[model samples]
Target: MIDDKLKEKVQMLICGDLEAGEKAQVELLINESSELQSYYKSSKLSWDNLDNLAGIEPSKSFVTDFWKKADKEKNKGFRFFDFFKFNWKLAGSFAVFFVASAFFINNYFSDVNSGFTFSEDVEILNQLDNAITLNSDSSLEVYGPW
Candidate 1:
């Protein structure tokens, strides 16, 4: 098998892309190596086949039909229902996500302030048989119904 460097040079030579000095060097090597010579012939044949290829022409009505299709699409207006027509799954997922987020927020993250009670001190005070009052001189006065 030919080495990679020599094979690349041979391909470049077949495509006429090699410089003058490189072309002469590769040609001399090809003449000496039988394997390189056969490789060069096959590469040249492939290149010639590619060079002979011609593009197929479009049908006579292709341009007119294309323009008619383009104009029809251009005149068509976008509708709100078009989003659901092609993307029902995406819309459904969004709806499910919104419902799940609402449930999680309401159930897992309920209002902590609503659970608090500021009337506990007053309830305890009412439970006492005697009333405890704070005097203006920072003294405690215990009094009852008298």
Candidate 2:
């Protein structure tokens, strides 16, 4: 039986999880010891043989049935709970879309002028283009000299 420390390191080496320096050190140690070399060889062979095993593929409906069964088991005796288990992400996205549509429609089709008008502000500024003064007796009223 391989010791625990060497067995663990051998597994790490076989799985390619060891650093370059640690891998070189382990290889050197294994080469110097016949018992470790034999253990590493067997471990490496077993690991490599795993890739040669055949893979089993499930039917296309296997995942659908699996989730259905899982959901059924989750709400086994409480049928009312299933009604509240719908996708929150889909519901939240729809709520956001409706809110955004309402906001856009309110702003775009409203008769009230509640938004900023850059042209109006620029006209007001142009009316006082050179009316600013730094005098103590002057009052800086809107769009007029005082």
Candidate 3:
């Protein structure tokens, strides 16, 4: 468990913002605590070495170069639809085929159901011939004046 006073100093030390008294306190805490010592050593190593990284200096164009590379890599990222366009075309063609099939089936059933009407010409002709023959076959006569 880190003490409150030591915690404040540790934060200042890591941030490189420790005052003289804070630095003394941070040193004492680090000397007494293994955890604090480890944290301090790592912080010191990184902070102290950062200034001497191969004596390397950044150019004025570093920021522009960083942005250019970042933008290029971001644009190179795969878009969601680029790999699935062929599937989309296949699905579209399937939908069109399904719709046309439905239309043809509806027309075919409608023609069979509604366009096939009953034809009465043959039955009517047969009935008319029977009536003429029955009228002509009256064997008996009328009792009164013909």
Worst 10 residues of 3 by lDDT: 137-146
TM-score of each candidate structure, all chains considered together = 0.51, 0.40, 0.27
Best by TM-score: 1
TM-score of 1: 0.51
Stronger candidate by lDDT (1 vs 3):
1
CA lDDT scores, all candidates in order: 0.81, 0.81, 0.77
- Of 2 and 3, the candidate ranking higher by TM-score: 2
What is the model-wide C-alpha lDDT for candidate 1? Answer: 0.81
**What is candidate 1's lDDT per residue for 9-81, written digit by digit as tens?**
9998877999999999999999999999999999888878997889899999999999999999778878766
Q: What is the per-residue lDDT of model 3 for residues 1-146, given as tens digits with 9 covering 90 to 100?
A: 66776666776877879888868877887899898888767766877887876766899999999999999978888976565667988768877999999999998797678756235556777889998877766633444436
Shift in Å, residue 3, candidate 2: 1.2
